[model samples]
Target: MESTMTGNASGKKKEIHVGLCGAGIGGVFAAIAIARAGAKVTVLEAADHLGEIGAGIQMTPNVARLLRKYGVDKVIGDNLVRFEELNLRRKDGTPVGYTQTSRIEGALDQPWWLVHRHHLHQGLVTVARQHGCNLMIGSRVVEIDYLESNEVTVRTEAGETHVFDLLIGSDGINSVVRRTLFPAVKPRPPTTNCAYRAIVPYEQIRHDPIASTLIQKLTMEVWMSEKAYIISYPISAGTDFNMVLSHHRPHPVSTVEDISMADLRAEYATFDPRIQRIVDMIPNAQRWPLLVTGPLPSWSSPRGNVVLMGDAAHSMTNHMAQGAATSMEDGAFLSVVLREVLAARIALPDAIRLYERERMPKAFRKQQVSFLNGAIWQLPEGEAQRARDRAMEPELRGEPLLRSPNLYGDPATVLEVYGYDAEAHAERALQEWYNGQDWRKDEGTGIEAPVAEKVMNWFLPEKEKFVSKI
Candidate 1:
């Protein structure tokens, strides 16, 4: 597939093709969306073999709703475990605040789900295949060419040249597309915050009394101490449990050269006795420094055809668990805007800008909020701990954190974010591009697409197979 770069100054969609970089979750879904909108999409993944590695991912209702609309709900539904609450507590496991996941669920008009990342990626890959999205794995993008006509030509490490109407830089934080677009800015190094993620089988935990209790609750629990926080949740719900320990480290670099179960136990030695019991049950762990980036000046290329998505565009700490959700939202919105722009015969450059215009502000806001959440979650040691204790002491005794002026100074601030409907916004954006509709009306009216089941059941059998094997 090849095409000579040309300016669509006349605003026509007859010649737009998209080259999507990265075949991870973001790139896969983006391909599905663009293909569903009747556009030709080519996905280039770097890894020789493409697969997901993470244990558990929290998919908010907003994200679920988008998956439902984009014809990938079957896989998501089959792979997800619905989580109903967000429980916050002190290091000793004393309750500080508990909020019903329903508040977020009802707002997004879908269920909040915890799913294994591999299954989610497989589901997206399946959908893309069904939609005629050409996927080439092991094709690492080494360079990008953004022409004056707002077209992109990507060259792979194998010396293969792929040209398309638009190039999407979904390759991730260390994106080659991003580097080529903005060479001056080096990616920020990993910060002091480090995390150890481990998944333990539920059967092993059933033998241990304390571990069994933590697993039986079906609750995503967090034990917070001045030094660190331990969070674990049932992923396959009774089959396996995933654990994440977040802590502040001194300037000395902590490497995971010999990351054994013993090392994991030692790290959590200071955790509450109950948390320690669960940590002891864990047989394996992977440690990595959590790297985050502040907001960027622009997410689009200087000429406008190439753009970034997900971690590539805005990599932030996982304090809010909105990383995957935001990326899914990006995939959903980009597909719609690109399709509408083509259908209405809008200029390619303007279409790209419109996308950047709509997504950048929302993404930047989430990035900022996520950063703040991380800072608050991992406050400085001495006086900060005391101040947190004073603020939480009343709440622990029975007052709600929402009302204590501690957690959230005003709960209303949440309405701005938890309440966003990305699909509704995409539709309004489509209407504006196709029929001259108002953009402001789409802003926060809570108008969302009602959930629908996809016709294809491609993922049902795979889910059954994975579950049965497990």
Candidate 2:
């Protein structure tokens, strides 16, 4: 365990020690980024094994671009299925609209991909290990203490205490770190939305004539209707088909239970014949309650030494498929700020503040948009639904679906969400902080000075400044 202090005997800059709570996609990715930025990182995972339980995850270009930047793209790309287009259909498999992802690929300079969650998780674990990040599995973080010396002390359930310069709460929605920091903030109850997921072997589906053609083209398909929607894509290098069916419930289910194939079929009885056939092929499915968190007043602790990332900060609905992508973006941004802090270009507190400042707004917006997008997808039949279908009819005529007026208010079309550059945003923030443009001013006197200067001066020697008193 290396300390985050400088002034070593070798005359080299001391490594910034970072402790991350949770070793899911967000934590592992953050560890890799910070380790590559020349910081020493340790990830604490409560699970005995480092793996993902989900069937598949959609990787948009925004996330792919950062993975490429970290050189982990190849690892994920090797096992992923690249789709050329996204198809929106009705319950009966009638084409409503389509989006050529090729356009997105060309504009973002990266391809969109679908991958098995386990494969992606394993790939990230390998990359983080290669970058020298220490992974502590089965070590649940039960408590966190901010020491008076400006260090964060993490205590695990295994009775181990580790001190670090900063602590990142990348734990998922039920984060203990977040609860310890903000005890009064309770996550909103699960909405009426519930998702059922299952993976069927391509071989099983390929034997059927109707399903065989679906696997051949490598396309992401969505069946939208009133009160329910189904999204299916090929994963595991097209060997398996991942499916998720989100439906509205009149009342919330108390627990996630194994849903038998017969019950699943009964639920989708009104769906298209193709969907019924696919559901029949699945042996079993798991029901997952779609839980969302209300916006928190802040993502960082009062001291700014501890902060939340990923779902711990903003757990959005999976409507836009930005849940994992946004978390990876958080990792990318934090890496840049940590690198600057390690190089002495900025203070650690300022780096963390900048991270929160840059990420909080975008994260909250994604949360809101995810909810809204899901609502639009599950719109009931009426004049509004008819208008939406009419708007989508242009795409069937070879026109761009995004050009439809109906999609103007949709967050999926927002360039900031889809075309964000995490690295560039981080670099710009650091540059501004370095140029003294990000300084805070006294309300009454209007005296200006970098917030980093004020925080650093409390720990280090004071330096001469333009304005002596604020």
- Clashes in model 2: which pairs? none
lDDT of 2: 0.78
Lowest summed lDDT across 10 adjacent residues in model 1 is found at 449-458
Give all candidates' CA lDDT scores. 0.69, 0.78
Give lDDT tens digits, candidate 2, residues 174-245: 888889888887665357888898899988987888767676778888888888998998899888889999
Segments of candidate 1 deviating more than 4 angstroms:
1-15, 252-263, 380-414, 429-470
Model 1 scores a C-alpha lDDT of 0.69
Instruction: Let me know the TM-score candidate 2 reaches against the reference structure.
Output: 0.87
Off by over 4 Å in 2: 1-14, 253-255, 405-414, 436-470
lDDT string, candidate 1, 54-147, tens digits: 6787766657766777667685556677765656666766665555666556544677677778877877888889899989988998878786
* Highest lDDT model number: 2
* Candidate 2 backbone overlaps, count: 0
